[model samples]
Target: MEAKFQIFLILLAVLAGTALLARRINVAPAILLMLAGIALAFVPGMPTVELPPELVLLVVLPPLIYSASVAMSWREFKSNLRPIILLALGCVIFTAFAVAAATHYLIGLPWAVGFLLGAIVAPPDVVAPLAIARKLGMPRRILVVLEGEGLANDATALILYRFTAAAITTGLFSLPKATGTFAVIVVCEIVFGVAVGWLSLRARHHARDPQVEITLSLITPYLAFWIPEHFGGSGVIATVACGLYISWNGPLLISSATRLQGIFFWDLIIFLVEGLLFLLTGFQMRLLFEKSKAFPLEDILIATALVAIIVVVARFAWVYPATYLPRLISKRIRERDPAPNWRTVFVISFTGVRGAVSLAAALALPLALPSGEAFPHRDMILFVAFGVIFITLVGMGSGLPLVARWLDITRDGRDEHRAEHEAEIAARREVLAAALQSLDAITDDRRLSDEVVKLLRARHESRTNQLPDSLDPDAYDVSAAGTALTRELIAAERKFIHVLLRDGKITDETRRRIERDLDLEEASLSNREFRKIAL
Candidate 1:
């Protein structure tokens, strides 16, 4: 792994550059960073770097998934949890088997190795899409589905991959045993995850300060993951469960200051982990390429294509049926929302993209068997895995915009028009209605003593044409930057104080004063955002 300080600086530069460029080009910043990392790999003198598999998978992945899941609106997640799990577990298994069979026949790889590859590529990278989707006004329903899927698919994929990889290595395949193990892994992971989350909340309850509370939350993910993995269970599942538990319990047990601070703290952790993984992919992967210098490129391409096909097709199978699952049970969903039309299904199906998890799982394969013989076709695996990532990240990256546009799924252009039209109309209506009402009531009294009414009449009579939907922009813009970030900071500081007071870090009197100050600041900030949007 690269030095922490150097990695941090590099990530900052990458983030800043990507942010600026994304604003200019109007695309996801993460997409830009991924491309930049790929480009950096081929440049001279940038030493190839390999991230430790444990660090990337265990250390980086848990918090990354947990943070995203924790931040999700629980109401939405609870409603959509079934479909998301189906997509993650059911779909992943389907893809693995489908791809495994396809790879065995088409590419002539061992069935087990083929399954391993399929499992690797099954999970989606929801982070990039979620961040981009927010700006695009993506429906909350879709966002929750994607978030839940990403948070969970790893457990399915990793467990399947582990068993399949072990069988491939030892030549001891057992379907019944693997199935049994899978069941155990699922149960243990869920139980352990809930346990860790509960304990973390308990610790926070007794903590002495907001900063300490936040730190405890930070440590919980890794702890949740390690404890489960050490016991031969799915760490991924445990961590996600823990995250959801704590998040759901947060409003009740956590100080508001701790709650807000914990979110941003985890967010930064996720950003760094995701960013560094991509960068390391650029670096460490070159070694595998060099070691496999003689591997044929055409073979790699064929395998990648086959694997990609299975991954996409599995989602279609899972989603088409899932879109209507609400009909099966009562109290399961909010309402009988219309099923996703074919166009929407097409977009959702194609959302499958191989990413960091796939790459890490593929790379984690042992180089040689217990007898010291070389792993079968290891180079081919690497080549295809890397190829899949490249094609998916870049190829699918380029296509998403086109697909969205064709489906008329984009909200940007329409939203702007609606907003602009409404603002103009509302402003006019308010001003003119005020003026006319004042004039009509004051005319008879004006000669006697109607000065105040005249002033009111002047204020109201200014405008006749007002849009019913529009509001004044002036009322919204409180800060130079939008209310989104500043308001959050105020709330966060308030949370810190709340945690402090609860944990005995601060006196109730001081805490009240600090909280009152924050409440005022946050209220003003929120008003500004509303005003900005309304105007």
Candidate 2:
């Protein structure tokens, strides 16, 4: 128990240190964390740390999927539904088949075993590449599609994995029946997921207390996921459905306090989960290394290379056709959503970085059949899966920023961001105008005092005046400088507040209230500054 606790602490330290270094170097934390884990694994006298398959599949996945689903904009997700489905459902299946064919033909694995390997490595991980792409400011739609695909593709891959594994175990396979079951799972999970979301929201809304509401929010994903997964369905779809339903409906029902507290809570949870997950994924390198001695190094190398190359090539093969063929075939699609830039499509293809899910799925494979025979090529599958993850994450993840820069994708992204900022300013003005109108009505209806009315109007006016009229370079520079000065002023005020507290000029309760106000102001300033930099 002591050793286990020590290892956990070590992992947390590595996670935090690697993330900080990655940010400093402008690299994805996932990439660096994985590398750090691998390095630590091979260090002399470092105790072996095994990642439990159940821990990932049952424990880690639900919250990760739920958090991402909630973060996604339902409007954007719906608008891009067709492309998302193409990548999530169609592309995943296509990639799996492509892998199965390649491995069977090139490496002489049996059909079922090859397909199992395919399913294990099919879904692209959402964490690593998306991190790199967001920092590089890839186009918003591409991010949506990629993120949407990441949210749901695991279900497809896992289902395929189960079916293929069952076929190998029982020697029975039926494509038509499996297809029907797949359709049923998709439909049922969506309905079930939405139901879970609706219930969760109602529970939290009535709970009212921030602590209880946040606790319910944490419980939601597991409820949506575990039941379906227990009954042989991928919990991913259900969890995603639940999250989307909550995202679309929670604002009106949820208390502001809960929302504020929940954001920080979820953000912290996701950061730790993602960072530790990648690190542990890298730790598998040592285990795979020890297992590799049984097989010839040449065979493992050849198979890993073949599958890695096929996964990359296969994405390119499917993405180009899937992206454009619809536009060519249907005028409706073309008119409603014109063909995206070829470069955008190319980036999407290049970002098929396999992640921890693949490793987890491979690790979860059965050790033997019911007949007591060893599971075919189980160790080999683990090796290849890890190799593919390492290759795509390091190779594709590192190269993505360069590709985005070379394609000049960020130019359009910057324009879009500027437009968004402009829209935000306009919306602020409109809302303030509406508030002033409301104030006038309230003043007359309630017969408010002249003092109160004047104070409210001045507050609204002050807020309206804070919005910049333009996002031009000169305006941006002025805004930036003003914000910096404001922060320095706030820091000075904080120092004075501490001095007052030290002199016993204020009670602790009074000091806390003042500090809270200052904190809120600083937080708002930080948010604005982040947006300015993001733009």
Which candidate has the highest TM-score of all?
2
lDDT of 1 by residue, 58-105 (tens): 778877877866776667777777778788888888888888889899
Give TM-scores for every candidate, taking all chains together and pairing residue i with residue i: 0.77, 0.98
Report every candidate's CA lDDT.
0.73, 0.91
| CA lDDT, candidate 1, residue 204 | 90
- Poorest 10 consecutive residues by lDDT, candidate 1: 462-471
What does each candidate score in C-alpha RMSD?
10.7, 1.3
Over 1-535, each residue of candidate 2 has an lDDT whose tens digit, in order, gives 9988999999999898898899899999998999999999999999888889998999999999999999999999999999899998888899889899999998899988888999999999998888887888767888899999999999999999999999999999999999999999999999999999999999998888999999999999999999999999999999999989988998899998898889999999999999999999999999999999999999999999999998999999999999999999999999999998889899999999999999999999999999999999999999999999999999999999999989998887888877777887788789899999999888778978889988999998987766666787677777778788988999999899989999999988998999889888888777655255344
Q: What TM-score does model 2 achieve against the real structure? A: 0.98
Model 1 residue 243 lDDT? 83
Off by over 4 Å in 1: 1-8, 324-338, 410-528, 531-535
